[model samples]
Target chain A: MKEVFTMWKNTKMVVLTAICGAVYAAVLIPFKPIPLIPGFTEIRPASVLPVVFSLFFGPAGAWGSAFGNLIGDFFGTLGIGSIFGFFGNFLYGYLPCKVWSYLSPQTEPLINHPALWLKYIFTVLIASLGCAIPISWGIDWVGLIPFSVLANIIFLNNFFVSLILGPILLFTLYPRFKKWNLLYSQIGEITSEKTFLQNIGFIFILIGCFGGLLVGNLTSLGHFTGKIGINLIPLIFSLILGTILI
Target chain B: MSIYLYLERNTFIHRLHPVTKIFLLLLFFILLLLFSSPLPIILVTFFLLLVSAFSRSISNLRKIWKLMFILFTFTIILWTIFLKNLNYALAMALRLNALIFTGLIFLSVTRIEEFTYGLNKLGLPFRVSFALTLAFRLVPSFILSAQTTIQAQKSRGLDLETGNLVQRIKKFIPLLIPILATSLRNAELLAIALECKGFGIKKKRTSYLDYKFGRNDFLTLLTIFLLYFLLLKIF
Candidate 1:
């Protein structure tokens, strides 16, 4: 949270934000037309960039991911989806460093310690799930795709790609950045205090995720047609949750 | 920089104000999504295709059509498997097609500068718009650097083509560093250049270009507004 203000005040961080955004869009635009599941699933090697950049540039990475996804959408899937895509990509690039640093591991380079690899995997999975939920859920609520299908597809797409490529890039870049003292973790202060607002934010996110999943399951099982007032409950809950987090 | 979709043509659609055309695109696109019935969706898709043809952007539209065809087929198959209704599948496919075509047609006709001008006139700050333009402008350099890096790595016997998913991804790591280094250097130079030009020196900046709302924009907006209501009444 403090890093965001730090980013704003620093000219170098501002320039890096724009550069990272351009790089992200450049990596993604080539893959825009190649849909793995045709309309829905995409083979985004660009998925790996977010996690890496998040760990590398911190808040700048998140802003870059948001803007990059917005620009990348112009290649094909733009309009309403871009709104959700922005937040979703922000989470994708944000949660990795947030969670990783929150866990408070003192490892210099993640590759130096084999045990920290699990943390990397865990970070990537959480980030991927965090990103997938908003995007798939938003698109489904907008009546574009089935919640279950899109959610699982996005989850798998981001998770596996990031799991595979994210580490390799991290491992490759970490030592280099560490030697250069360019790693975000090295320069930026990782907020360690668990504030009351953050706790409430996490609680809202938990409720949103659990409630949304239950709604998706119930809708799929024909228990509800997704039109019940109850469906909006989770959406509204997440909206509040999102507002808090932002 | 590779804004390859916008064809430099003198068609009437191309002549329409960027904001007006974007408004129509959004209106029709929303209408396309609002209707659940196959008839309206199909009608919207047809209308979009017709507009593309009328604009003489058939060649540009054809490129997107190829991709859209794949999307349509994928939608039909997926929906058929999940929903077990061919009619629903077809309708969903049409909706997806409509979404893609709307974007394609809009980008094909609107120049980047015109779109950015429209955005600026719509009250977006100059810095935000400049960042957007910078991102787009830098894309080709990033792509070129990526290509050069890949070529450089390939010459050193790195086989990116014949690897499994993990291996291929591993191959990409070598390419990432060079690209990042080059991009960072370029960003520094750009930042210096921008500061030298006295960016952010003034609170309010001005543009030389002005896009006026002519009769075509008015007629187009009115017609689309009426058509939206008319469609709602009919459907």
Candidate 2:
């Protein structure tokens, strides 16, 4: 988290952030004509760029993803809900590297082994959910889109695109980035220690995000009843607290 | 393929200071959200249209009218299906349209530099603002590179249009890899260039463009506040 701010101090990181953002927007803007949900989202195959850049550029990637989505929104979808879109994209880019660091600190982001592949899948799932929860909740809470509708679409879109494209991008580009000394690990000192607080925070993120999704779906679909199901403010707070701690 | 919506007009709205424009944008967003009923929302939409016309940004709106129409129709249909209420659906659709139109006007009037400068004035960090402006400028070039890659790939017998969604997406891999690689290489060069030019050596920096807080900005801000209160009272 500190690196997210600290990376701005380094000129290369700043340039990398801009590059990541520009590339993402470049890929994204062309897809604007093809809408999955008009005025809400599109067929965003460029979603994988953030995940891939996350593994390589770390904090810069997170900021890049956030800014890239903002730039994309400037095309048409720029509105009050874009604030959530910004944060959602930041999480989409931020969570993958953080989860990967926690899951396998020593190894590079390669997918040669079955265990590594499973970890990759889990990492993408968390990142996808991390991105979906806030945007869906915020939009739904704002009375624009339903929580159940958006949450599922965003999750599936991010998960499937990243799951398919992330590995190929990583496999081809990881070595090149490492050789160029542009990987976040090479540029910044990453602490490998697994602290107790970090483990707990990770669990909280899992529970809060997944639980919010489930509860949101159930309540919106009329499967859940009572006061607890009606209000999502508590879950959102937990999710925020989880990310902060993690 | 150009992403920028800014129209170079010498209208009053275009001449307003960046901060004032940003404030007005936020104020309109709040106003839109404060009302869920169709009548008030429609009024706001009319007001926004008037503003767009006065600002000479209606052409920008025209460019995105198709998108707005589709969004309006789909939102109404979706909400109607979900909530079983046609009036509610129409209201929601109008609300969404008003939001989009407001954003369109903002973008149409505000340049990238003005936007970043406004954020910087509003307490965003210089580095962040610089990166944002840089990213905005870089988008067109990246798009150009992507187009070149697509053409090169097509010449090499790559088929992008002949597949289902998944297959079409899979075809993008070849296109993406080359553009990404080139961009990464260019990033390294850019970083080195910036470092050589003493990009971060000074603690403070000056802008090339000098935007003054003129009387127009002040008047616009006051009018916006008054309009907001009046709308609140009327609603």
Candidate 3:
């Protein structure tokens, strides 16, 4: 997390951030005309970039994902919701690297082995949920779209794109990045050992994100009769707290 | 491929300081949120239209008119089907349009340099701002390269359009690999270029563009504040 800020001081990281963002936005803008849900989500093959770049560029990739999505929104979807979109995409890029560091440290992210493949799948799933939860919650809070509708759309969109494309991109590009000394591990400090509290924070993230999605869906869909607005506060808080601690 | 919405004009809105423009955009967001009912939303939409006209950037709105129309209709239809409330549907649609129009006006009037400079003035770090400006500059070129990659792949008999949704998406991998490889190579070169140019040597960096708080900017801020207070009092 500290590296997310400190990386800015290094010119190479800054350049990597700009490149990641430009590439992400470059892919995103072309798909704008073909929306899966007009004014909401779209066919975002660009969604895979954050996960792949996260594993490669680390914090620079996170900030790039944030700013890239912001640039994409500037094409037309820029609005109050974009503030949430920025942070959501940030988590989308941030969580994979963080989770990967904890789940399988010091190993190549290639999907050669079955266990590594499962770890990659789980990492992408968390990152997708990490992105979907806050964005749906924010848009729903703003009364633009329902929580159930947006949460499901965003989670599925991010999950599938990253799941399919992430490993392939990683397999093709990881060695090139490594050979060029461009992997985040080559540029930035290797992540330290996971602390006890970070493990606790990981649990909190799982509960908060999964619970937020389920409760938001149920409450918005009328399976639960209570107000989602009230129920989501603590979950959102836990999500935020978990990100910080992680 | 040219995605910038900034129009070159000498209108009043264009003359306002960049920071003022940023504030004005935020003000529009708050106003739209505060007034969510149909009538108030209509009033805000009308007000935004007037601003667009005054800025002489209504033509810029034409670029995204299709998106605006589709979204407007989709939001209404979705809300109507889900909630069975026509008035709420209309209000939501108007609000979304107003927000989109506000964003279009902001982009139309402010250049990317001005945007980053304004953010820097608003306390963003210089390095971050530089990255944003660079990203903006790089996007179109990357888009161009991506287009070239898609064409090359298509020339090699890749079928992008004739597949199912998942297959169509999967087809993008061939296009993505080359683009990613080239972009990474370019990124390495860019990093070295920046480092050689002493990109982060100084704590304070200077810009070629200078912004001043002119009378127009002050008047714009005063009017916005007055309108906000009036709305607060009434609503």
Candidate 4:
């Protein structure tokens, strides 16, 4: 968190962040009509970007993604939802980089080994789940969509869409970026054994995916009719635990 | 597919302070959420449309009308299924329209730089706001590069159009990769330029442009707050 502020003071990081945001918005703005769940989510080719750039450009990519989503919302669907969208997109970009750095066996992210491939996929999964939980919670909190429907929509949309596509973009761009000496690895290795991001990841996986599924099942079974508030207890508890761990 | 949303126009809505417009955007968004009745939603939708007309954003509105119509109709159908009432369906549809149109009007009328200036006035840090503004400037160029990348891939017999859902998404990688690579290269060059120009030497920075709340802004703010409270009281 402290590094985020210091990174903001650097001119090079600032410029790079601007460029990443602009390029992301450019990809997103024109694809407004290709809706998967009309009036809510869409087929976002820009979805893969956070993963790709997070690995390549580090914190700048996270800030760029957060701001880019904010600007993109002004095009349409600007509301209370935009706040969640902003933070969700930030984590979308941030978590993968952090997870990749934390979990990667190699000094830098590469696909030369089979184990690294699994780590890459795991990073995307954790990152996508991290994104879906809060956003679905936010949507449900706003009373716009059910937690079940939105959680599934966002999780599947992000995970499946990027699962195949994200790595291809990563593989395509990685060598070039590495050749140019622009990869985040060149900046420094960010892995720290003391950080609680792993606990945060496990908490998200435990609560966000499993807890959301339990609530969805209970709701469908008519066990919790008109009791959304009561139903949120365990989910909220896990979130609090995750925050406390952080 | 490349749509530049901001239109330069000399109109009352265009000339209004950006912060006022931002406030109105937020207000309309909240109002749309607050009011479930069709009448207030319709009223807000009509108000936004009237503002759009005055701003001469008809062309921009035309680009999105089909999409908005589909979304509105879908909302009505879904509401009808769940809420089991035609009027409730209509209200939900109207609410969706108000939410969408308010955003469109704001984007169409506000210039990118004016928006950044508005953020600056509202106490956002200069570097952060400027990064966002710079992103707006760079999007058009990036769009062009994306189109060229798609074309280059097409020339190599990469078919993006003919595919199943998964295949189509997979096909997008060819287009996305080159664009991303080009964007990174461009970003590195810009970083070098910024370092050369001494972008971070001074912690305290000054801006040549300024935005101030005027008599009109105050009056507009008062009217909107009154209208919002009145809407709340009425419903």
Candidate 5:
């Protein structure tokens, strides 16, 4: 216990990072979507604080980032679904952010090939749906959306948006705050962004479409819709159609 | 420090892998949603609460008390004016209470560190996991900073407490500008701190603590299996 406190003593960076996340949440309250956009309902992808924490502190920092986001949602975006805010925002913000960070040069050499960036997109896709499933459950049960059906429909609505949002946050915030020991490895690099990100971005958009289709279908198939084609056809169409364009 | 706010003892919940908990929570919530009726849900909810207490997460009840009150009061008010049916309102309130308490129990017993280790062990990158740790460390500091800033301003005769709703909100804005400004500058410094470390030099990184499976994890898995079957039965 003392070690934990001792590790953080005078670590103003940690305090400041949390404050940054809270402030981002506060300022973002007014920008929340009106539910008019089916999937693009969230206001800001505010990954700055989480990105900052991951870069500066390490894995522990990333968890704090998720916690910080929940706190942000609690004070800034409280709603009927406030109970689910922790999971919803945690997955939406931190999960994807961490995945991207892992694939970056900042992480130890796992799969160093440049093409792995393409694979990274799929990781984000898995993470998005991965986290979305739980969040959707919370959002659905809390009655945040009138029906669980509609909630599932819109669960991964912002999957692609977060994909784009997360990498940028990581690229921007990491270079400025990463620690001295870790910085030595990538001494000249400033941010995580580069040509890799551009190529990866395209891959992510594609993956999002595909992952969305997959989730959309699995959900509709498992769902008990008595009418023969009532729930089945449109569900496949939307997922497939979105995959093609997404 | 409060036992009512955070579980005091280590138990299955306090010991299970955080990532696993994260997954079980999702499954649990989905199962919770399969029914609209209150009878089985009432029984399930009662059982879950008992399990939470047994897991030594009774502290969560204290933290959720305020939100529970708000939900209860809001339901009552709405029911009195619109539905005119006490039964429906009470049922809805009970359902909501069950869901919220379930979440609180999950959070209170699980340490953020456990989750991070679980995350890293389960293939999440060290940098990302570290980000989570930093944020947890920072939250307490942030609250302190807010208090200090508020006290500093109040000492200078700032009238933070003496205005109407909009006026009071407006007053806070001026105070907020400095806080925001300081926070951003702090973010920049933190960014530099990260940069100073070899953050992106490698493709993989090592976590300080390694999370692995054990007897406690096995117990959690059994619990998850039992709960899953029970939920399926009810839903």
Candidate 6:
């Protein structure tokens, strides 16, 4: 019975995680005025779902959340992201989950001072070793994959310095934030607590509810126009606010 | 977009709505998946350049030149070494040149406001349209942030300039921490602001920017569509 419940919870978490990621990716479309970060990269913060999921559900939850991010890319109008992005963001979620799962709540997210640096070091290492070659080749950027090995080696070795700096962000001196009450009022204790199960459920539920709205709007507002860039600030700001306040 | 872009403004293409331009670009993108050949592609490039000239301001020529000098030169060398077919290489480079500039023609002149208005007219929601606006502004903001981060590292005596191939790459290690950290913080801020504004609510939004469909808009779309159709039929 316990196993059955765990499986059910896992399924729910995965579905929810993907939905949030999809929402983050999909909500980006109306901003047709802005060119994406040069070569199709954007500063997507939907990772909160994955990070939180990894913390709670372990590796499988991490996997589900990571893969779930393609929701927006697949459904959106541009569809350029759907093909390359499936794997591009998958690992982005997986690494954090793997790392955090590798060490649970008993261990602090920060191994040293300034949690930000360690996170960066971990990210670069994962991108180089786990993602770069596999992603480039998997996505059919075969020509570009030649540099992956070199890129990974050059990247991972420098992780030491940044790792030392990252701990400052976690618990040591990180700001408690002013907007926590906004998020806390509507949301339950499930997400607020640092437990693995609550975090997984909260992350997925949030993404689903959040990302779903944009899709619903897209269906209704068939044609969009006007200062696309300026309009986007609010949407991005909304996502940030949701994670913090809720 | 960077200040480097210069535009050539005129009636036909310029008058066409940004939403229309975006759709046409999409149409072309879909068209490419369906069809790609040298003659048809080259003809398309020629038409794009001609249209591009009329599409924006006169100042965008500098961007065209810089792209040709930098991206063109780089691609040519890379293609030649790998593909090793001089003709194929040159042809590919030219194609890239044409596509980039034509897109730049649109990018240089169309302000975020114009794009938003055009997309909203095309039936996209107010929130989605707004996100487009933020993404554009974020580019330069992100770049400035990256540059400042690098300079700070330099001040810390990172000495990135004197590094080897592996070591030179190592210099970038400092960037991911700060950039990603800032990004996470920004994400929280962006998400909240959007929700409070009633983003993603199902409703017809008011068009803040007025768009006029003059004689030029229709004629231009028809002429291009017809030309594109004819070209497609030819192949």
TM-score per prediction, in order, is 0.87, 0.96, 0.96, 0.88, 0.55, 0.52
Q: Quality of candidate 2's docking, in CAPRI categories?
A: medium
* List of chain A TM-scores, every candidate: 0.83, 0.93, 0.94, 0.82, 0.51, 0.40
Question: Model 6, range A59-169, lDDT digits (tens) per residue?
Answer: 333334334443332221123323334544444344443434233323434445445445545543443233322233322221211122222332232233223333332
Ranking by DockQ: 3, 2, 4, 1, 5, 6
> For model 3, how does the per-residue alpha-carbon lDDT over A133-198 read when each residue is reduced to its tens digit?
888888777777778888888899899889888889999999898888788998899856789878
> lDDT tens digits, residues B1-235, model 6?
3432424355566556777766666555444333334466677767766765665443555634753566556555655665476665565555555555555556655655776687777776454445445444444454465567767877898774564444543454465346434433444445555556655454665655677776766676677678768877888
Candidate 5: which stretches are off by over 4 Å?
Answer: A1-19, A22-68, A72-246, B1-8, B76-88, B121-125, B161-165
Model 4, C-alpha of A60: deviation from truth (Å) = 1.5
Give iRMSD, candidate 2.
Answer: 1.6
Q: For candidate 2, what is the recovered fraction of reference interface contacts? A: 0.62
Residue-level lDDT tens digits of model 4 in A1-246: 444566777666787788788878877765432456556666677787777778888888888888778777766666566777887787787777766766763446656578878888888886676677667666555444456666667777777777778766776777788887777666544555646666674565457546755675466335767544456556745643543343
List model 3 lDDT by residue over B1-235, tens digit each.
3578888999999888999999999999988888767887777778788989999998988889998898788788878877798898888888888888899899989988899989999999999999988988989989989988888887999976666668877888998899889988867778888888888888988888998999999998998888778767776
For model 2 the local lDDT of residue A28 reads: 87
Give the Cα error of residue B11 in candidate 2, in Å: 1.0
**Model 4, range B24-65, lDDT digits (tens) per residue?**
888877778887678888777777777778889878778778
Model 5 lDDT per residue over A1-246, tens place:
122223332234344435445554443332233233333233233333333333344333433444555555433132335544454444344333335443464563223356654754554554455344444444433433222343343344444433444444445434443432332233222235445544554355444434444544454344543422233334334322322221
- RMSD values for the candidates in order, in angstroms, are 3.4, 2.0, 1.7, 3.2, 11.6, 13.8
What is candidate 2's lDDT per residue for A1-246, written digit by digit as tens? 778888999998999899999999999866432355556665578989999999899999999999999999998779988999999999899998999999998778988999999999999999999899888888876677777888998898899889888898899988888887788888888888888888888888888788888888887776877332246667777776767667
Off by over 4 Å in 2: A31-42, A225-230
DockQ of model 6, rounded to 2 decimals:
0.05
Q: Individual DockQ of the candidates? A: 0.41, 0.67, 0.69, 0.52, 0.08, 0.05
Comparing candidate 3 with candidate 4, which one achieves the higher lDDT? 3
- Candidate 2, residue A139: the lDDT equals 81
